[model samples]
Target: MRQLPKLSFWQIWNISFGFLGVQFGFALQNANASRILSNLGADLHHLPLFWLAAPIMGLIVQPIVGHVSDRTWNRLGRRLPYILGGALVSMLAMFMMPNASMVVAWMAPVLFGAIIFALMDGSFNVTFQPFRALVADMLPDEQRNVGYSIQSFLINAGAVIGSILPYVLTNMMGVSNEAPDGQVPQSVIWSFYIGGAILIISVLVTVFKTKEYPPAEFNEYKNISEAEQQEKQSFWVTLRSMPKTMVQLAVVQFFAWFALYLMWVYTTPAVAQHFWHTPVGDAGSAQYNEAGNWVGIIFGAYSLFAALFSIAMPWLAKQWGRKTVYALALLAGCLGFVSMYFLTNPNHLIVSMIGIGIAWAAILSMPFAILSSALPAKKMGIYMGIFNFTIAGPQIISGLLGGTILKTFFDGQAIYILIVAGVSMLLGAIAVYFVDDIHAKSH
Candidate 1:
């Protein structure tokens, strides 16, 4: 195999920068969607149902985007076209989401909000899966960890900004965190707007600055056989031929994403009820809004710690094996999530966030790094797209059963859902031990 040249740190950073925008948008969605929906009249039990929009979008969108982008080469380059297109759509979605009430006067704001949520996440999925393939396409095997680590850093950095923006606007700039009946607060409205603008600008930097190898050069560098390069197989057919590592990774992904789904769909309610002493289904209350803002700060802490951890993770992985580091990071997150069940002080949550942040870093980078070495050169994009099922699948299952489980087992307490999340993450940590990393020791 012709070795791909090592990229400078800045070169890798620039290539991964577009993800900063995607994760920024994602952070906004994760931190605020429950709040926004509740403000618009949805029950807490239905929040997970609403969140099904994102993963469903990812499940359908990523593989198609991936399959098409694998064959898509143009002036903008293979992944750039999708990256740019998705960003533009995402910008529009961000603008539309918080303003879902105003758009369709005849429809319920909650329903419109769900639709917009789908669009926002669908657009993110468009950019996200390709970004994964892009790293595998560009970086040599030895540099793959760096590429993904840098990508993880950018992702968490963007998340930190996005998650905190509403709180910043409310507290620092004196924007109103309250709104009229059935309307989202001004701080949230403004965060989406700013996030949209930054999304497009950051994506433009990547589209304009980074270049992709043309098809001919990429094939030569990866040493793909001509017949394999030209070969077309149905996704299901290719699924049967999947690498053992990908299958193993999927098992771990299921639990990791299941845990994350609980956090995203329930954290606002859990924190509001537990720390802020808000009533169930309390929307548009001062206490609830305060809880929402604090959740933003807390989620920002999660991403900030994730960003900080990303810098240290590669070194840790190199010292221990990647799988070992991944397991330990998830263990930290399990402790963090389980602790949330017992903590009532808002500020003390930051201590718990540190562990989740470390796990988030490993979750973002380690699996992809492990999988990249096992994937076929000719099908990086499609396989990366398919790997997303591991992400979206568990979340889908969680969303479907989440409400029922909560009511049945936990007396509908959101805090107890976090305990379930902890258990799931613990399972993921254990599953990490079984993954067959092709470069298990080296990375």
Candidate 2:
């Protein structure tokens, strides 16, 4: 079998640059979606259900995009076509999401926001799944760690900007942070608009600057026998034949994503209530909007730390082993979540983000690095798509439970939700210990 050629640093950068755009759009959604939903008149109890659009659409879109991208070969290359198409759709969705209330006065604002959220998420999955596969495809085993780390770095880099955009706009550029009831802030609206433009432009750079190996070259490099090449693996067949490592890693992914889902869904309300003393129904209050923008800055802190930590994760993985590093990182994240309950000063939450950022960097790079080694080269895209199930499934389950948990158990206290997230992350840390790191084993 001929090994894949090692790509130069710039080549790797070019291929992974699109992640900046993808994450730029995604981070905006993550940091702002809850605020938007609340602004559109969503109640605190039902917020999780409304935020369901992202993970639900991801559940449906990622695997299909992966399967199709695996078989596709066009002038735009296998993954690039999907990347470009998804970027355009995502750009439109980002632009429209913040404006959902404005477009249809008669439509329920929550419903409109949900539809737009799904569109943004589905488009993101289309680009995201293939991009993961592309890294595995283009890089040899020795370099896959670095490739994934670079992707993580760019992902968090974009996230930093995306997360901070609204805060920066309002604070520095003097954009209005407050709007009338049922409308999102002008700062957030402009942030989305700028984010959309950057998303498309960054993706186009990757589409033009990076080239994919043709099918014949790819088959030859992986040493696929003609018969094996010709045999099409049904989705069920692939599902049944998944590597044991992938199955084990899925367990780790589940709790990790579940914890993250809670944070994303409740952070805005939690911060508003905890720091700003805004009541549950005060979405239109100036204090509430200010709290939301502060959440953006807090998220930016984590993203910035994640980007910096990504630079060190690969080396740490090499020294301590992937599973060890991952588990420890998750443990830190668990503590980070727990720290939230004690934080009286909102800005002090940046300390909590340091631990969370370490985990974020590890989460973005480690599983993919390990899983890529165990996957069949020909089936990389599909398996990566299926791997997303672990991510989306946990999120879906968490969203379903979030409202019930808030109403029944917490007395509508969002701070308690952070404690639950901390415990969930602790479970994830334990789960990671069970994953067999094929890369570490092989080395």
Candidate 3:
């Protein structure tokens, strides 16, 4: 039997706290960047391309990080080194992103911003892969669910604060909301600085305070035969021969992420154009900041519901099984997306988001758990990295297609993009029914 050292609840909390900071960066990006692009004179049709850097970077970085980290086991620990390094780089990107329009012209600003954002986004994933593995390393399988749940809670908690920061700063701090056309507001700039600082500090807290299990413990369950581990195939060969299950999950992931990309890309515009009844780029417009605040409220509703639903999921899983629970969540999300077509009032958006949030929680936790159970312990890092390719790859595909859909089918009506996305998610939910969860358990 492999003996694992016990981690107390607080110790687990301390180790995972950095994710709160990371989510702060992600929340700000997801909730507001498209709106910021519009403020900075980006064409509505071109906005999806501006978000492309993140997915492209993720595709390249995650695998390399996993490959390298698998071969490393240093004194400060293999994962912690990447965690600290990535956080510092991401902090720099966070500080520079809001200032991009200040320095350059037209798409130049966004081009430069995307470059930095891509770097930071990729680095963050580097740290993220190993960190989850670290939990599996330190905790017994029974405690695994609790460890991941804490991480999920922190992710949502951080999102709430990050989502609300722009509203808080604009309303309470008297920060200047106005900027030269094609520039981010002063309040948003300050939010990035604060977020960057928190990013570094939160990760550092974990690095200084938490100790990793040694290599012996990490490899105790990793005693596969050398012949089994030997590679007759190259990277391209393995890539070509990717497991059928992985390919199936990728299809499901593609639709799931595409829908989410649509939501993140167009929520503000959907609110501003459809619900708030306002045109873009009008300052004294009641819809301008109101749209921004409602974005926060909508995001807060989804994230808060995600947090709540994550807690309820274990119970649901017990009663109906994970696939059934996931199917119900996706069905709810489809209904929520369909409802957006009818949403005239801003308050109703929150109700729609509650449905989406249930799906979001399942998206974050369940797929990975299912995938992790199937992968070999030695290749967990690589397989997880490959799993992330599904995420980034779909986002890239969505970025390309979402823009086209918004421009052509929707007639620049971003809400219809969500309708398409909702249908996509429904397809993803249906695909989950075919996955072999029985094999996952036997493994």
Candidate 4:
């Protein structure tokens, strides 16, 4: 086995640049999926049920893509094939998601939108899970933090653009925010159209620019023994022998993803009810649409903060260690979620977003930085795929229980959902304290 060479900054950048577009599409989805679903006749409580498609698809798709890509080798490259394929499908999904009313008339728009949501997220998981392994595949141990932080930066930067595109179209270009009954707005539609284009182009850049090593060389660089390569490893076998770091990190990931799922599904309705004063089930109203666009603005603001915060992650990890930095970052986000309860002004939401963004930066980079060092190189993809279980599993639980929790415990006040999400994040922060980073840095 040989030590892998340190990747140049541009090489690292090209490898991760596609994530910008991936997150861009995701940002648009996060900001507007609920709005689109509600416009198509989904109730507030039903939002979680409809949102279930994302994690369900991730739970099903990521591990399969990871396991397959691990064994695959072709001219298109192992990860790039999946990356390109997923991006193409995601682009098409994005193009059609906002236009659900016109996608098919036989099915209701809400149902159609959920289907698109699943397709988009499924494709995203396919691309996303591989990129994590690719970093471990390409970089030496020392460069892992820098590599994943750059990924975090691109992810958030794309998110900023994606989140605010609709707002920019509506306010800057004078496009309509409000649509005809049961239809998506022109501004939102165009945002998806533009986001789709960016998604494919950015992925193409990564596909062409980044060169994956061939099997002989990769096996040598990664120290994959011939015997290990020849052995057929089932997903369950991989799961059972998974690293201790993976299991420890799963506890942290579960709470973090569960909290995020709550926020993504509930934030729009929460804003509308708490500040915009729109009546329940009035997703079609002008004020409700305005609130939806505002959701975009604030979501973009958080992405902006996350981008800036990601720039400092490597340095932070160096000074404080990955686990400590991760815990502190989640703590910031937990406090941010708690702050949302007292936010009377829509503008003040940006303050809360800053904390959330700080948390987002760590969530994107640190765990992977920690976990990648601990995973076996040959099974990196499959292990990374299995890791999605932690991320997807909790969100699945959140989706199943969130609506009922909202209706049963909170009596339909969406703001309380954010508060509950805060508690979940706080738990994540505490859970982080328990994880052992195998290659941890310290003061």
Candidate 5:
């Protein structure tokens, strides 16, 4: 059996740089999508349902992209093709997403936003799943942790820039943050345009700069026969034979993602109501838009912290064990969410974000680091894609149930949603204790 070669630090960085752009698209969505939906007159109760499109699209698209990328090989390389194609689609979606309310006067904004959200998310998943497999493809086991942490670092770095774009456009550049009734803000519009352009350029850099091993060479590295490589395995067969660690990690992923989904769907409204005293029905109010931009700043803070903290994750894992570090990170995130209930000032939210940032860094790197060691190299793409189901499935369930839970139990107060997220994150922390960390054990 031939061993895969270790990648240089620069080579690992080149392979991971495309994630910077993919995440720019995601950060823009995460920071602004709910604000956009609310601006278009979406009721708070139905907001989660509108957000549902993202996870649903991700659940369906990632596994298919993974399966196809596994079989695919071309001059642009196996993963770059999907990366570039998805970048193009995401760029288009970003440009159109903020304009959703204006595209059709008769179509409801909520419905239009849902369609655009799905497109952006679908494209992101197509691009994202390949990147996960790329790390496994290019790096040996000893370096996989470093490769994934670098990817996480770049992901959060891009998110920081993307999350802050609107705020910078509004506050720094003096662009108008408030739009007329039923219209999107100029600051948000420009942010999306800039984010889209950056998304393309960053992905193109990875496409042209990074090289992939040829299929024959890749097969040799993985120790798979040409006949075995040629034969397609059914998804079910591969899924049924999944390692125990994958199943255990899935439980952790479920509650963690469920907590995150609540934060993403409710944070805008919660902040607007709690900090700015903006009413839920008054989407077009200047105070409401100001609160939305503040959410962007808070998102940027957390992302910036995540980028800085991710650099230390490999070292932290070595010292504390991956499972323990991950569990502690989730506990910190729980406190972050719970802290939101007590903050009266918007700027003070940064303290809460510090905790969330630690968790975000862990969430991005730890699972992939552990999972990569357990998965077969030949089936890396499919397994990575399957792992996304754990992410998207919980999000889908949260989207379906969140609005109802808010309306029935919380009396439509978004603040209570954050409390629920805090509790869910605490449960996730406990669940992570059960995951078998093969990498940690081996070390």
Candidate 6:
């Protein structure tokens, strides 16, 4: 195969375009899944159980997909095929999730949607890790910051649109807000359908338009021979002997993701109870859906900041160093989470999201940038997959424990969840100082 020229700005934009759709799907789901579950008659205490699909899928699918992508070299290239396949699955799952309450009597439809959600989420992560690695493989170091920033922008932008879709459908389209005691609102159903179509189209753009680097170039890890590919240590062996960096990163990731999971899960409830002063089943009231939409608006604000900060981070790292910049970002998130406790008006919530958004941008980009430099190139996919365990594992822990805290300590109120999340973010910031980024400028 002939050597392809480096991608232009537009090329990078096109390749990264799918995430816009992916985030749209994910943002809508993440911001509202718990709300949807509650509307379907799930207890507040059991909400965490229903939200378990994401971390579970990430834990199981990422490494396997990473390993497969490492060895894959086909007509569609290494990562695009996985991307395409995942997009299709996620779209179908998105469509099903909103309609889950339609299940017949005696069968838990929410549970059914949760299962399909697991499948979709798992498939998406399988494709996601490889896609991140592909960026590392394709871009030179200088351009990586730009590449990732564009991605962050798309992620937040997509989420903003997704989160607001339900509000648009319900308020503007005259959708039914009430659905007896066991069904979902028509607005949410419309959001999922719209999200599904957008998801498929965005992913297909990359599948059809972008070309990938040849496999031989990707496999030249430490200048080692691919001839002894089998002679090299097996994945199980590598799994047994993980690098120290991955181990430490995992420790930090546990706390970081835990905090984030809490924020996403509880933001709506916290806003509804604390800010809006409303309950889930309040009729003829827009408070719940309005609070939900405000969460989207708040999330979008953070994402807007995150996209801007993603650009500044690389430069900031060049000056004060990665550790310091990351530390500051975490501190900002901590402050943001803490501020939620003091928020009286709904509009004031935007102030908190700005800090969380800074942390969000860094968490998404800096960790990958740090890991890519330290990991073995030939095993990039597998290690990246393994690296994802840090992200997924904490989420699982949070899913289990966050519920316990909410029920036992706070009487199922969501404010306490944000408090725990704030502490977790602060703890994660402390851990960042210890991470050794080789490419990061010396202080």
Q: Can you write out model 6's per-residue Cα lDDT over 253-276, one digit (the tens) per residue?
A: 877899999988888888888888
Of candidates 5 and 1, the better by TM-score: 1
lDDT, candidate 1, equals 0.92
RMSD in order of candidates: 0.9, 1.0, 2.6, 1.1, 1.2, 2.7
lDDT of model 5 at position 223:
86
C-alpha lDDT (0 to 100) for residue 400 of candidate 3 = 90
> What is candidate 1's lDDT per residue for 55-75, written digit by digit as tens?
999999999998999898899
- lDDT (tens digit, per residue) of candidate 2 on 1-443: 78799999999999999999899999999999989988888888888887777788888999999898989999889999999999999999998999988766578877888889989999999999988999998999989889999999999999999999999998899999988888888999999999999999999999999999998899999887889878987899999999999999999999899989999999988999889988766777888888889889889899999999899887888888888889999999999999999999998999999988888988899999999999998899889999999999999999999989988998887989988999998999999978888669553
Could you tell me which 10 consecutive residues in candidate 3 have the lowest summed lDDT?
A: 280-289
Candidate 3 lDDT over 273-347, as tens digits, reads 787777643433446757876797689778888888877775666667667877778878888788888877788
Error of 4 at 169 (Å): 0.3
**Candidate 1 has what TM-score?**
0.99
Clashing pairs in 2: none
lDDT of each: 0.92, 0.91, 0.75, 0.91, 0.90, 0.78
Clashes of each: 0, 0, 0, 0, 0, 0
- lDDT value for model 4: 0.91
Off by over 4 Å in 6: 1-6, 172-176, 220-222, 279-286
Q: Which stretches of candidate 1 lie over 4 Å from their true place?
A: none
Q: Which stretches of candidate 5 lie over 4 Å from their true place?
A: none
List, residue by residue over 1-443, the lDDT tens digit for candidate 5. 78988878888998989899889889999989988988887878888888888889888998899888988999999988999999999999999999987866678876787788899999999999999999989888888778999999999999999998999998889998988766789999999999999999999988988999999899998888978877777899999999999999999999999999999989988998888987756677888788888888899899998998899888888788888889999999999999999988989999999989888988998999899999988888989999999999999999999998988998777888999999998999999988888768654
The regions of model 4 sitting more than 4 angstroms off are none
For each candidate, give its TM-score against the true structure: 0.99, 0.98, 0.92, 0.98, 0.98, 0.93
Off by over 4 Å in 3: 3-6, 105-107, 225-233, 240-244, 280-286, 439-443
Ranking by lDDT: 1, 4, 2, 5, 6, 3
